[model samples]
Target: MFALGCLALIVLPLLGFIAGLVMGGQGAGLWGAGIGLIAALLMSATAALALVKAGRKR
Candidate 1:
């Protein structure tokens, strides 16, 4: 589960960045990429915290 979350943390934002590039231009794409990266980092951090909490409970 944690591994999958980590994979999602990489893949999801990459997809978003590519989509942004295709749909928009350089500026929009850059902005989208930045947003995607930030979102991914936040998501990954949250997932990591959750996993750690669960492990501690166990």
Candidate 2:
């Protein structure tokens, strides 16, 4: 469920943007690129936080 949620939030939106770009143009590309950047940043932060918590457990 968690994995699915992450994929939906982080992957699908980016895919949408790419598809839009292919079908549309620069504006769609820019929008998708922006979303991809934000999703990547958020996923990176989440991974970092999880690593910290795991490290503290040891």
Candidate 3:
């Protein structure tokens, strides 16, 4: 469940960014893609931290 949530967090933004690039043209698409990538990275980091904390607790 946790993994699925994290995966969704990472993938949804990426898909949206790709869609934006296809429909919105270069400038807006680049901005959206940058934001999406940053968001995905942040979510991935948060998930990794949570996993580490969980492991330490056990």
Structural similarity to truth (TM-score) of each candidate: 0.70, 0.62, 0.63
lDDT of 2 at 47: 70
Each model's RMSD to truth, in Å?
1.9, 4.5, 3.1
Instruction: For candidate 1, write residues 1-58 as lDDT tens digits.
Output: 5676678778877777787888897776777778877877887788889988988984
Q: Over the full model, what C-alpha lDDT does candidate 1 score relative to the true structure?
A: 0.78
lDDT of 3 by residue, 1-58 (tens): 3575577676767776787788897766777777777777777777788888989984
Q: Which portions of model 3 miss their true places by more than 4 Å?
A: 1-13, 16-24
In candidate 2, clashing pairs total 0
> Candidate 1 or 2, higher TM-score?
1
Among all candidates shown, the one with the greatest TM-score: 1
C-alpha-based local distance difference test score of model 3:
0.73
- The lDDT ranking, best first, is 1, 3, 2
Q: Per-residue CA lDDT of candidate 2, range 1-58, in tens?
A: 3354466566756785787699788798778767776776677668767867888994
Instruction: List clashing residue pairs in candidate 2.
Output: none
Top lDDT: which candidate number?
1
lDDT of every predicted structure (CA atoms): 0.78, 0.71, 0.73
